[model samples]
Target chain A: MTAVSKLLRRSETAVLAILIVVMLVIGVINPAFWQADNLFNLLRANVVIGIMALSVLTVMISGGIDVSFPAFAVAAMYLTVIAMNAAGYQGVVLPFIGATLIGLLCGLANAFFIHTFRMIPLIVTLGSASVVRGLLLGLVGTSIINIDRMPPSLIAFGSSTVDIGGSKLSLMIFIYLGIAVLMWLFLTRTMAGRAVFAYGDDAESAKRVGFNTRRTVYLVYGLAGALAGFAGLLHSSMIWLANPRDFVGYELDVIAAVVLGGASIFGGRGSVFGTILGVFMLTLIKNSLIIMRIDNTWQGVVVGCVIVIATALTAWRDRKALV
Target chain B: MNKLTDFRRFVNRDNNIVQLLVITAIIFLLMSALEPHKFLRYYNFESISFIFPELGIVAIAMMLAMLTGGIDLSVIGIANLAGILAGVFFTRLYPAGPDAGAAAELMRVAAGVVLALGVGLLAGTLNGLLIAKVKITPILATLGTGQIFTGFCMVLTGGPAIVGFPAWWGFIGNGKILGVAVPLILFLVVAVLIAVMLTKTPFGLNLFLIGTNPRAAVFAGLRTERMVLYSYMLSGTLAALAGIVLSGRTNAAKSDYGTSYLLQAVLISVLGGTNPAGGKGTVLGVSIAVIALMLLASGFQMMRFSNHLIDFIWGGFLLLVMVINVLRNRGR
Candidate 1:
């Protein structure tokens, strides 16, 4: 009973309970929401954003917020496609690797500015986001790569599916899940991960305790960039197009998801499981609004309300605990 | 020797303003030298005067919010919603007929302006309440509220531009008084009021103290919450003023209008020497920074550079400023 009560008290449990309630409500309103194909589609939709949320989770856990990952992702995906077309390289691995490295370099730029200058991560990332996006659109090219120009191997890889109960699920969904599991392990089982949490809780104490704060910052941001790059490429593949303007407004959505998952905006408090649940909850709401026959225009308002209420509740709870 | 030292102290104290003035001068000289005829035109300056005020106002609003160690990401949303609501008001009630009297038209436009400013105040108050009362982080709260405001805009407009504002309303955006643009005059008045308020008033001092150290401010018996709420409300009103200027200038409002201004506002505020962490900024520095960037932008326009390239340059300029500020701080 005590164990069950403790489980019930966990933040992730609250998110899970709320998510289930939301899903049931949506399902009751629209039976089509329960369709296997629609559910699979929701899972597939989760792949890109889910991966991005994991990246954000890492950054949030390390006492930093990155609004630049979307820009990095789009830039990597666009540039990789351009390079593939230029070199006539069709292999999946090389392109993915290239995109990840590009993202890492961009992430390193953020780390360098933030760590060296001790600048606020938000402003540094904002500056870098603009620079990367402007460079991508201005110098590289603003044109879209159509399906005809997209590498056949990449498209094929994107289309590959796994059979589950005779319903086809995109292979990318599995990859997303795999990445999430790996992230959970790394965050829980690794010393470096503990250092990230330590730094987030109190940077000065973490430093006094002999953690390599610089390396942790780099690792956290670098991994985030690499994941964002991978997700960007995956997004393009799934959509079967490479547009420089893709993910123009995804930063907020990803951040909102991470925060919704019970992560403190101030850092040092969140879980991988909660983040996954948060992403799913958000994805479900966004994907099912049409099915629920709600006006599409209300989407932003609904999401905004959810964010405010959730954060306010958490704030109130924290204040209560202090009292 | 004493006079020289006094002058030096003055220069050091207002270092950001001095640097911005030098940058502004350099930009002005470069633009004039590069395209003497096009860049130095009387019409060019006039057009910029009309346009820069809206942006300048929004930047100042951003500065105020940053002064509290907070940010208002919803400024653009508030601006657009204010304009759209006013536009909706004008379209709904103000009749377009020969029978309509000038007084009635003026009254209607006045009501519409109030409604717009009211929307700004309400939206800003909501942001303030969320941050101060609910105790949510400022950035996240503003981000959420910005979306809500934008969503309301979408609901009202349903994806098309709202047009048909009264003819008299255009004066707010484009009219001239004493050979000076009305918007420019409004901007000047606002700049002076805010500068005085920031430097000369207890509210302003309290804000700076709160931003510098919230715990200390509280310990000193300051009502930090109320001050933050008022600052956000003021910021919201300023944003609405920008919205009025914008819709007036264009004679239309839309959900996505001035989307690019959001980034530019943040950039200009920081470039103007407002510390993002809060507690320090000035109207003069922000004003000069806006002018410098505007000059640079107009010069690039003269050179026939693409808008994308201009955006790239702006981003590069922000990074350069960041690096310079860091180096300067370290030197100090």
Candidate 2:
């Protein structure tokens, strides 16, 4: 009984409850929402954003925020595609690896400036976001790569699916689940992961306790960048087009997801489970609006209201606890 | 000898203003040297005068928010919403065929301006309440509100530009007063007023104190929450003023117009030496930085550089300024 009550007290449980409630409400509004194909489509649509949210969760856990990952993601995706087309490379693994590496480099640039100058993470990432995006659009090419120009292997990979009870499921969902599980393990059962929590909770104390704060910072941002990069490529593949200007205003959405998942913007709190739930909640609300027959114009207002109300509630709860 | 020393001390007191002046001078000289025929033309400078004020005002608004250890990402959204609403008002009550007397037209435009500013005031109040009373982090609160504002704009206009503003409205953006661009004059007046407010007002001093140390300010018996709320309100009004100028200049208002200005505003604020971490900035410094960037942008355009490259340079400039500030602090 105690264990069950404790579970209910956890923030993840609240997020889960909310998610279920929203799903049920939407399902009732539009019976088509409960269809297996629609469900699978929703899950598939969440793959890229889910992966990026996990990255954001990591950074927030380390007491920092990154608005540059979307820029990094698009840069990696566009540059990787451009490079592959130029070199006549046709494989998927090499492009993914190259994109991830590029993302890691951008992340490190952020980590370097932040660590060396002791600058605020927000400002550093903001600057880097601008630089990466400007370079991608300016130095490289600004045109979108259509299906004819996109590598065949990537499109094939994107289109590949598994039949589950006569329903087609994109193979990308499994990768997202795999990454989420790995992240959960890394954040829960590892010494390095604990170090991240400690640093976020109290940086000065963590340093005094001989934790390698520098390594923690790098690990957090580097992993975020790499995931963002991988997600970017995956997004292009799934969509079957590579647009340089993709993900222009996606940072807020991803950040909103993570925060809604019960992550503290002030740091030292968050979970992979809660974050995934948050992503689903957001994705469902966004995708189901059309099914529910709501005017598409009201989408932004609805999402914005949800974000503000949810964050305000969480903040209020935290304040009450302090008092 | 005494007056000279006093002047030196004044200059040395805030090195950022002097540094901004020097940078502006260098940019001006370099642009002139590179493209004398194009850059030094009368029309080029005139166009810049008309263009920089909207961005300049928004940057100042950003600086005000930063002063209180917060940021108002909703500035651009507020600008657009204000402009769009004003456009809606004008379209609804526009005198057909100039049948109405000139007095009525003037009244309509004046009412439109008030309505636009009122929208800003209300939006800012919401932002302030969210940040102050609700205790949500400033960034997240503003981000959500920005979306709401933009979404409201879309619902109002149904995803198209609202055009057909009054002819007199254009004068605010494009007219000249005593050989000075109207927008330029407005920007200068706003800058001077803000400089005085920051330096002379009790509210301004309280903002710096609160940003520098919230706990201390609270203990010192300051109404930190109210001060923050007021600052955001002022920021919103300034943004609305920018929006008015923007709509007047373009003779239209759209949901996505000046989307890029958000980035430019942040860049200009930081370039002006406003510490993002809060408690430090100067109106004079920000004004000079905006002009310097305007000059650089114009020069780049003259040289046929893509707008993207200019954006890239602005980002690089932000990072470079960060490094310089750090090194200088270390030396001190």
Candidate 3:
């Protein structure tokens, strides 16, 4: 293929170009938007979304959509916090393990249902989303979790950061970046990662090629659940309180970002880089809307329009490629 | 041998109808047993019947879209928007006056219904165009348009409900006609219309063919795109009708009203035996499913069950039904 065609084909390139254009427009509209402090704040605010976007990207690339991530994250985070408060556990590893385990179970349930029934992943995840959210509310009610009494290690993780040119950066940024980098390696360089793409591309063919599609499906969903769990822990730490309503409707945001990042909802097409850009693009749109003094009610309008347009553009591009 | 063969045919015909009937029986018996004092009362039944149609109409609308292997998540959005539009037109065109005559009131009601239905048709047509013409996936397209519609409604009302309807406006929602609730009658009319459309018409036959195999349908000279568009339009209009019932009953028009109904609509449609994958469902199946769910929901509410638990049950019930359907299909 020609270099121009190859470059145009890469989702990351297209996303990066769009990101630049958006940034340029926003910066032109309000130079204050380009301020380092504001930029850092935006990244800090979107750390959870950024992290969750990667998990979604991976799952989507593996040929499934998990709308239950928010539910998994909230449930895991709540369980961890409740456990720590009740048992007085100090170390972070215990809580992380606890959260990840819950995520694993939720993911397993998702995979089990999808595989056994041969049902659409979207429908299965949709049902599971409610079940988990309902369980959260039914079992825990509307209680708010306060982390004021948590161990110092937990506090440090949420609050501590290195001085980067006299700017306050939360430790969560590094965690987010670290996970993205690792995910990049896993998706691009590992056999399992290749298998994920293969399975997503065509499950029947992947099975014929000796790839264990079902196991891959389980692992992908389980890993997504685990990452969501970790992200939830970080989220609760950053916010210092876990309300039951927290993260309830944020799955749509995550899905939108991932889709914007150039991941086809049809699966077998997405990247970690694209997801990061997608998250950044969405976060930037949100921040820009605030900067431009747009009413909060219009935020949905802007985001929804962007999602639809982005998907439409992607669909058009796919059709063109086929032609 | 003839009697045994006849019994086998009865058992084997339409598993879903049988399953729905058996489920209805079980829930009825259970509710009767548990709430022996209240369940069988005419008042309780009336209350259940009163609240049934707003959701039932929307579910039937969703069933049409599902029959074409697509879903209309925009139902709630369109419903709310339609109500809001009707509200806007009604209040603006015929402001409430102290000495307004019956003629003015009749005009206001007629205007509201026409405006609401027109808005529903327009919104649904947009959805159909986007999905069929633009080739966007139903989930994302509806998701986006749902936002847009809701956003427009928000801009119209500025986040609060629009109130102040004529005194007679609530008749359709709360009044009874010949010993039957007006909304129930409306629901029945809608259900019958959809039933006839799906089973007794060539359009419905082609819809099933298109859903089952798009390429085959295309080869057979069916206008698949138009079929999908019409299906969505029909779904949208029905949802809007539901919105009218909702607004009338509550005496307000709000963008966020019945947010829960989005999922409940999908649940009801699925429970009614509408296939999510398309090409297989019936209006009768959906109506029966809605009744079953409403019964369960009311029973649970009467027992003072938490709303969260009810949500849990709804979600779990959806999953359970799908699983059973899978097993039954496999057995066949």
Candidate 4:
């Protein structure tokens, strides 16, 4: 690292370091924390959040907060499962595919508003988020859908684990890491991808420079919605049940992850590396808390504190950057 | 083509009104077509007018704060806290015969009003202090306070609702005065008082000017801070009063009583043509919009749809109205 970079360690680096230290402390206090089964379960638990955080990072970087992503995911998941079940197609792939496309469709609608209406992203997504969540609740009508038929492929997709030297690794971890790499490549290696970064930096300046900043904004939000959908698919497959109330506060966690990763909510500037580190940082804190056998209720308090501290620091940095 | 262009501008100029009318029409048609007898009743229409006043009062409070280029998310929380205080005192103030007939019960209600208003004013002043002195962004700072204050309410009530408030206080909520609910009449009085302050007084003028551009207002020698501070304090007091009304209407206090009002009140203000970025909008417009929303919702419920359906439609309608507004605004 450069000398200057050393003094001001990037948020991702700081987050990851904290995660590792916390992990080590947990392992020391309770060996069960580092145990193969428990760690795998923990990773499994964060799969949806980790994937959704990637989506949030994209939208936030593009100067919009797509709060509807989670609700859209719920819509996708419910519609897919209910439709396929009614069709007597007991296969999970059909539902997964259905949900993903529906997510993209919702994203497209969001994009249209962002580009056409110029409605503030927060307002648009939040409004639609409620609508979508409402529809999801309407569809299920207080009933849980249990997927027990012909879904070996889907279950295997989420259930598969790699045994690495007596330590088990979840398919979720691989899925999360895979998306991180794809995001990294898309962000760093492609023209449209880099344009996403530019638009996020400043829409006014970016528009002046002849970038189709408006269109790019739509695509970024669309992609975020799609990712949230994909994550929802993974969520349902792993749980083997579709409940409307599942992931009620999913958007909050995703935003928290992105902010903790050092992304600005006012838009422009984020790193895939930072987000990945954020995912692990929260995962670590949660897993460690469990390992310590502390009251689960304290989890909210701890997470809340970390989130405030992280966002405050990021905002402080943004203010400093302006200077 | 000429007709089409005119139609678009009409929709654009009065987007919120158009949305409200459209929603009302939809509900009317649905009721007539799907559930006629219940929907066409005049009682339901009257109910909408009555229920609307409480929301109207809150909207006025929200508009005053928004007019000063800030927000008061804590108002709903303050309302909830006030409601709980009212509930606690009602239960404890009288072990009377068949009602809270204890003269002490009246004192308790009075005490509840004052305490609630004090709590709300303190919260709003704290918000103003942070915004004026610490220079925190209004959105973020209010969001944080919203959480802290709401969290405190949840803690105070242990996340459950309070019920069994005094009967006399409940009567204040349910009683009619001169052919209108007493609370509704009270709301009208509050609205008129505020309308006078917002349009006729220096405080109101300063508020509008400050919202348009605080720096310019400051340069122009207005005490921008005082205007903002006063606006928030007024917002808090009004919200607290509304809380008392809401509790009396419901005959109980719940932690979640005003939780949903946060979004709904803001939506009404914005829908009433109040700019979120502030400077433009009137109490008259907002009051009308609030009445329209209540009518629309009650009209639908009267037509036999569930509350969930209304909520779904409400969220969608708000989105549609807000999007149209944004499309019209030439953002700088």
Candidate 5:
């Protein structure tokens, strides 16, 4: 009984329960939601968001928020796509490498500003997001380039599906799941990962404990930027277009997903399982809303309300625990 | 020793104001050299006057929230909603008919203003309640509310701008009073009133105290929660006023109108030397900073720079200023 209570007490348990209920409800309303084909498609659709949520989880776990992820991702992906088309670089590896490198450079810049000035991450990321977006707009001129013109191998990889008895699954699902498992391992097994949690819990104490706080900050933010870049590649593959404005306003949704996954915004509290669940929950909400025939315009309302309510409930539960 | 003290005081007091003046001068000179004919004209300055006040008022609203150690990202949302609600009132109450008299026009405009401002207050109160009562982090709370407010604005207007306001409504936006733009006049009045309240009122002092040291304020018997509510409520009302003027000037109300103003307002507030962590800012400083930015923006536009380039410059400038600030503090 005590073990059951302990499991139930975990915040992620509540989120998992909520997600299951939502999925069941949606399945009941639209029987097609449970179809194997639709389920696989849903998993493919959520890969990019799932990847980005992991990146956000890393930063949030290390006591920071990076709203600049979308901007960095868009900038890196756009540049790579533009360059690949210009140079006629056909292979998938080169584009991924280029995007990750650009993302790393941008991440280093973010780290430089945060380390040197010690400004609030929120404000710094906000500024950096604008700068990157503005640079893209100024240089690229808001043009949407079609990735369909790219190498056939990359497009095939993006669109390729495998048959399993009767259900087809896109290659992107395995990629996202692979990344999530790696992140989970890193967070649980590595000393550097432990340092990230300590830094988030108490920066000064982490420093006192002889952790290289600066390097941790750099690694955390750089990893996030790199993952975002990878996600950008996947996103372009999924959409078959590299538009500068494609992913600009979805930071809030991504942040909402991470927070819903039981990561405290205050820091030092989150898990890979929780983050994946959070991503799934948001994707479920979005898919269910569409199945319900709700207007696309009202989507923000639902997401915003969910974020506020979830955070409020967490705060209440924490307070109750204190008493 | 006395002379050194006086010099230090001057350095501390005139720092941001001096920065503002120098940036403004550089922009003015650049514009003069680039667009000698058009930039020097009286009409150009008048047009700038109309444009700057809407941005300036919103910046001031942001400044007030920052002074309370919180940010109100919902200012733009509130501004848009206020304008939308007022637009609704104008279209519904007046109906844009020929039989409407001067008296009806007056009533229509009056009702519109009141309703818009009232909605602004309600939005602010909601923010206050969430932040103070629910104990949610201010940034997250406001971010969520801002999204919801923007969604509401979109749902209300059905994604199209509401237009056809009364003819007299133009007076608030475009009219000249003794050769001064009405919006500029209103901006100054609001600035003065806010300046006085910030400097002279007990409420204002309590706000600063709460921001700088909430525990100290609470231990000193301050009603910290109520003061926080009051601060956000004031911010909301100011955003609403800006919205009214903005919608009136544009002669339309839309959810996405002035979407860019969000970043601009935060840029202006910070450029004006308002501390993001709160407890330090000045109306005069913010007003001067607004002008400096407006001049820069006008000069950039005249040079045929794209709006995107201007945004890049603003973002770069924000980072540069903080770098300088941090360096200066370290040196001290």
Candidate 6:
């Protein structure tokens, strides 16, 4: 492959490097870190965050950051759970659909302020983020409303695992893999995918070349919103409860993984595979801390260091790109 | 009506300061209406003025960084970290201390402040190196660093609050110079110094230029990296100062200490009309915004409002200002 093409592929390489290092380090520190049970648990716990990170990657690549992501997701989770409980609905699919729609609505609101009003994307999203979170808190009365009537199948959404020769993978892994493949196709194969990249790379230039800049920005944000919503549904289904407070705080971690995965905040770059690798690296590191019994306080320190180093490396790549 | 229109125009251009005064006046009026006996107490006014100085100090430092075309999301993090470190060093959290003798205590405080400033410098330099040298986007880099610093603080404290500072430094927090609180006086000195820096120093000039036009700043042969680095360092150090005061007042520090301040700082910064996308804003404007926010909080308290509701009100105001800015910019 040409050198230019090779440079374009480095995002995935960096994520892979991070994944390998942490995996080996964890394995060395505690042999059980690589054990099947623990790895599957790690995968299960990170399902919601990992999915959100993938969504953030899309918008960041398309030239905008979705600060409203966590808010949207949490809001969706809150609404779905509350609506289902209030309605006494029994169907799993209907509740999940309701959640997805809530997320989409939040995303569309962000896009409206961003595009139609010509507001700065960051400012608008930041505002909407707070508003959405407040709305959720107001709606949920700032309490954890547990879903006691959760069906057996619903409970299994987060718990069910398939055992393959005593080495099992959690259902979360499949969900992540499925979503990653779909996003990969969406970003690489279609006119919309090209638009996401072009808008992020240079929106004005994209507009000059006759691309629909406004629509592209809106769609990217909308897609980001929908995915965040979907993640909320998965989270509630997995955990058998919808929560708001913890999820918004987790957005920082998701953004960190995306950036560490080699997505440029400047937009027009990054991919799903890199992000998946980043999620795996973070999840492994966190779970390994639990296994090593090293106070788990060091989890933040380790993750922080990894982010700094990875970003530094990516910065190095960016310099080379500019040159 | 013509005169009023001109006056309104002036207020619009300088609305943050105007907004603060108007809100404070409105609050006092409301307080009197609710219960003239308690709300108009001299002590309450003293307390409000007393708390605002440190906030104003941090605001100026933050404004400097923002003026230089970057946001210092790490400010609150640094402040919380420094406060905890200061508390630990002062009270001897570990090593159980020689009880940190007065001289040692003083030394630790200074060192704590310096390290906080040093951390700021290092972070700012890293930010500069990336934006100037590595070509990473400032927003994402700062955002990452903000969390990392916050995570470091959380890790150090095990996600808990660290306590045990001598009440003596409450003197620092509650101290007054000729009837004005020490913090307020310090704030004034800081404000004047910042005003001079922005207008008098080449570094300041570089900041203004960079914010307005990076290409032009580069063309002017200004060391843009140095200017940006200096801005970040100042922001970090100022945030650390705020942390010190917070620790002094509360006699404790925690990991989650300044998470709330993240919104507070940004709210004031944005409310003061400092363009979030970069290049435009003033220290006076941010200071006014801080005062406005403080007043709003006090008003909420007077009205028997919960902290959560206060936050809701603050968020609502932020949204309103953003919408207005969008509409005005759209017209342009």
Which DockQ value does candidate 6 get? 0.47
State the DockQ of every prediction: 0.62, 0.71, 0.59, 0.24, 0.60, 0.47
Reference-based lDDT, each prediction: 0.91, 0.91, 0.85, 0.74, 0.85, 0.74
Q: Write the per-residue lDDT of candidate 3 for residues B1-332, one digit (tens) a residue.
A: 99998877976766678899899889999999999788888998898788989999999988888887888888999999988887887677668677878998888788888888889999899999988888887877888888788878887888999887666778878889999999999999998988898889989998899778877888899998999999999988998999999898888989989987877888888877788888888888888998999889888888988888888888899899889889988987
Clashes of each: 0, 0, 1, 1, 0, 0
Worst 10 residues of 5 chain B by lDDT: B89-98
Report fnat for all candidates as fractions from 0 to 1: 0.55, 0.63, 0.50, 0.22, 0.54, 0.35
Q: Please write out the lDDT profile of model 4 over residues B167-283, one tens digit for every residue.
A: 667866787877778887888899889889888998888888988987789899998777777787788778878888888888877766765576678778877878777797777
Query: What does each candidate score in C-alpha RMSD?
Result: 1.6, 1.5, 2.2, 5.3, 2.3, 3.5
Docking class of 5: medium
TM-score of chain A of each: 0.97, 0.98, 0.95, 0.92, 0.95, 0.92
The list of candidate 5 runs beyond 4 A from truth reads A147-151, A318-323, B1-10, B92-94
Off by over 4 Å in 3: A146-155, A320-323, B1-11, B91-94
Tens-digit per-residue lDDT, B178-261, candidate 5: 999999999999999999999899988888888788778889999988999888899999999999899889999899888778
State the lDDT at A320 in candidate 3.
46
Against the true structure, candidate 1 reaches a TM-score of 0.97
User: Using alpha carbons, what is the TM-score of model 2?
Assistant: 0.98
For model 2, residues B1-332, the per-residue Cα lDDT tens digits are 99999989988887888888888999999999999999999999999999999999999999999998899899999999999999988887554355877888788889889999999999999999998888888899999999899989988998999998998788888889999999999999999999899889999899899888887898999998999999999999999999999999999999988988987888889889888778998898899899999999999999999998888888888888888889989998
C-alpha TM-scores of all predictions:
0.97, 0.98, 0.95, 0.83, 0.95, 0.90
lDDT of 4 by residue, A124-216 (tens): 776777777766675456477776642445666667778877876776778788988998898889887888888888888888998887679
TM-score of chain B of 5: 0.95
Q: Residue A285 in model 5: shift from native, Å?
A: 1.5
lDDT at position A44, candidate 1: 93
Model 6 residue A63 CA deviation in Å: 1.1
